[model samples]
Target chain A: MKANIIIRLKKNILDPQGKAVHHALSDMQFGDVEEVRIGRFVEMVFNHNNREQAEEETRKICDKLLANPIMEVYDYTIED
Target chain B: MKTAVIIFPGSNCDHDIYYAFKKVLGAQTDFIWHKESNLSSYDLVVLPGGFSYGDYLRSGAIARFSPVMKEVVKHAEKGGYVVGICNGFQILTESHLLPGALHKNVHRKFVCRDVYLRVENNRSVFTGLCREREVLSIPIAHGDGNYYCDEDTLRELEENAQILFRYSNEKGETDRRFNPNGSVANIAGVINKSGNVLGMMPHPERRVESLLKHDDGLKILKSLVNGISGN
Candidate 1:
């Protein structure tokens, strides 16, 4: 099975990197950009027998290591 | 007092911390590798600053799971003193030993300079020797030192007096302009609820010698030693 994870800072959290990129885009005349938020994307391949088991394990991975609950949120999809 | 400085891979400040404890402070100290899990015999365990795991996933994200961190957690749970500095502070947060997280600097650039820290709570095991609100000049070098936490957690920390230091001016005014990293509440350091763990971004180890222009860092180190030695 393969798990694709997207981790991002919480909506209320201030992302300085994203702000900088937004500024750069505006400077380049792409002023339609309303906002930019930088985040992490991770793909993992592991052995799993069923979709349910893969989802559970992926949740565990996100909760334990991939995303910090203090300031970030994570979502994932599993495919086999 | 005996001290152990836990050294994770890519930790550049390990020797400096060891020297601060062993040579400058005259306390017996040893370097414990990240893979070694036993920390039962040390009075103080220090996590020094540096790019642990090269700041791979996130600052201190991967290093928190090192075999030695389990023992570090055990040590702290037993009321043993644990101080995490710079990147070490990030690890402490990632390990959930301390509340909140460290975000990138507000300017999105690595900040390295001397900054003034106001002693917010001198009653801690980490800051007992300092006068309340005393301004100490310390050097901070890190890109991800901006501290963040939810409002409820911030309220709890404030109510419990867990805040140890805040970035401030020479006169000890915690104005926004003095905040080097945009940390919430200008927090430069904080202690856990149990008061046994301390996580701070400033490098007290880097400024311990008077010959280097300031020994304000000694006040913090000496306080820890004194608090532990029953002095």
Candidate 2:
């Protein structure tokens, strides 16, 4: 099975790298971009017998490693 | 005193600290590779600065899971003295041995320069030789050295006097101007709740000798040695 994990900085966290990209987009004339916060997208393929087990394992991995709870919020979806 | 300087694959400051401990501090120091699982015999364990694991997936994320880190965790839990400098500091936080997380600099740049730090609380073993309000000049080189934590943790740190260092001017003014990376409360270093582990984003080992025109780092290292050796 495969899963897509989306990791984003918490709303209150300051993301300098994300702000930098927003500025660059303005310079490129992208226009009217209110804000941009960059984050990580992880794709994982592992051995799991079923979707429930895969999702449970994915959540555990996110909590343990893929996302730092101090600065990020994460969620994932499994795909066939 | 016996000290172990942890050598992660990309660690570049292992020798600098080893030299400082051996030549300057006159302590027996060895470089412990990251794969080594035994950290029980050392009096002090140091995580030196560098791009460990090429700093992939955030600064210290990948390196924190190294085989040796488990033992390091055990060592810290046992109240063993451990100090993490620069990238080492990042690892300490990533491993949950320290309270806060190191984010990218507000300026979004990699900074490399000597910065002044006010010894905030000298009661801890790491700063025992440093006088409160004493300012030490130490070099910090990192892109993700900005420290952040929740308000509750900050309040607890202050109440417990766990803060060890704060970026400041020579006069020890801790306003935002002195904060290089915009860390919360200008914190440059902090001790664990038990006060045994220390993490800071400064390179004290780089300036341990008078030949470098600064022996301030020596003062800190000496404190570490003396703290562990009870000298």
Candidate 3:
């Protein structure tokens, strides 16, 4: 199975790097730039037969190794 | 006293903190790697500052997930003393071990200079040796030291007296310009709700020698020694 995780800064937390990028986009003449918040993308390959098990494992990864709950939010999708 | 300095892969200040504990404070200090899961023997566990994991996503972001941090969280939960400095502060925030988050400096620059701090509350174990409102000069080097939390959290922090230090001038005035990263209310350091964990952006280890200053950082360490000895 292949899993793709998308992690982002929690809402209400200031995203300075994203804000800087938003400014740069405006400087480059990109019109209608509403907002930009950077996030992490992690792709992992796991051999699993059960969807529930994969999700449980992924949550552990987020809590224990991948995403920081204090500053990030993550969601993962699996493809077989 | 037996102390341990948690060493993340890119930690640059672990040796500095260790030297401060060993030579200045005359404590037996050990450098624990980030992968270690044991922390039961040390009286003090220090998360020294550096660009852990190259600070790739965010300062201390990747390091928050290090193997040793799991032990750190457990240690803090048990009322063990933990101090996170600079990147260590960022890690504590990233790990949810402390309230608030660090954003980039409002000026968008990596500031590196000595900054003055007002010891806000000396009742905690970390600042027990310092007088209330005493001013100490310490160096800060970081891009994401601006701390932010909601109004309610800030109110609780103040009400609980969890605030440990604030950025200030030599005369002890809260000068905005002296606030290197535009931290909220000029907060430089804070203890956790339980008062067992202290996270701060300033590098106290850098000021532990008389050659550096009057070794004001020594006083803080002494306070920890006193706390461990149950004095």
Question: Top model by lDDT, which number?
Answer: 1
Candidate 3 residue-wise lDDT at B76:
91
lDDT of 1 by residue, B1-231 (tens): 899999999899999989999999999999999999899999999999999999998899999999999999999999999999999999999999999999899989899999999999999988988997899999999999999999999999999999999999999999899999899999999999999999999999999998999899999999999999999
For residue B53, what is the lDDT in candidate 2? 91
> Higher-lDDT candidate among 1 and 2?
1
DockQ of 2: 0.81
Q: For every model shown, what is its TM-score relative to the native structure?
A: 0.99, 0.98, 0.87
lDDT of 2 by residue, B89-156 (tens): 99999999999899899999999999999998887888789887899999999999999999999999
Candidate 3: tens digits of C-alpha lDDT, residues B1-231:
689999999999999999988887788999999999999998789999998998887788788878898999998999889999999999998888899888778878999988899998999999888998999988899988998777888999999998898999998898787788878889999999999999999998988878866677777878998888787
Question: What are the C-alpha RMSDs, in order, of all predicted structures?
Answer: 0.8, 1.0, 2.7
Worst 10 residues of 1 chain B by lDDT: B124-133
Best by DockQ: 1
Candidate 1 per-residue lDDT, tens place, A1-80, comes to 89999999999989998999999999999999999999999998887658888888889989989899899999888888
Output the lDDT of residue B7, model 3: 94
- Of the pair 1 and 3, which is ahead by DockQ? 1
Give residue B219's lDDT in candidate 1 (0 to 100).
93
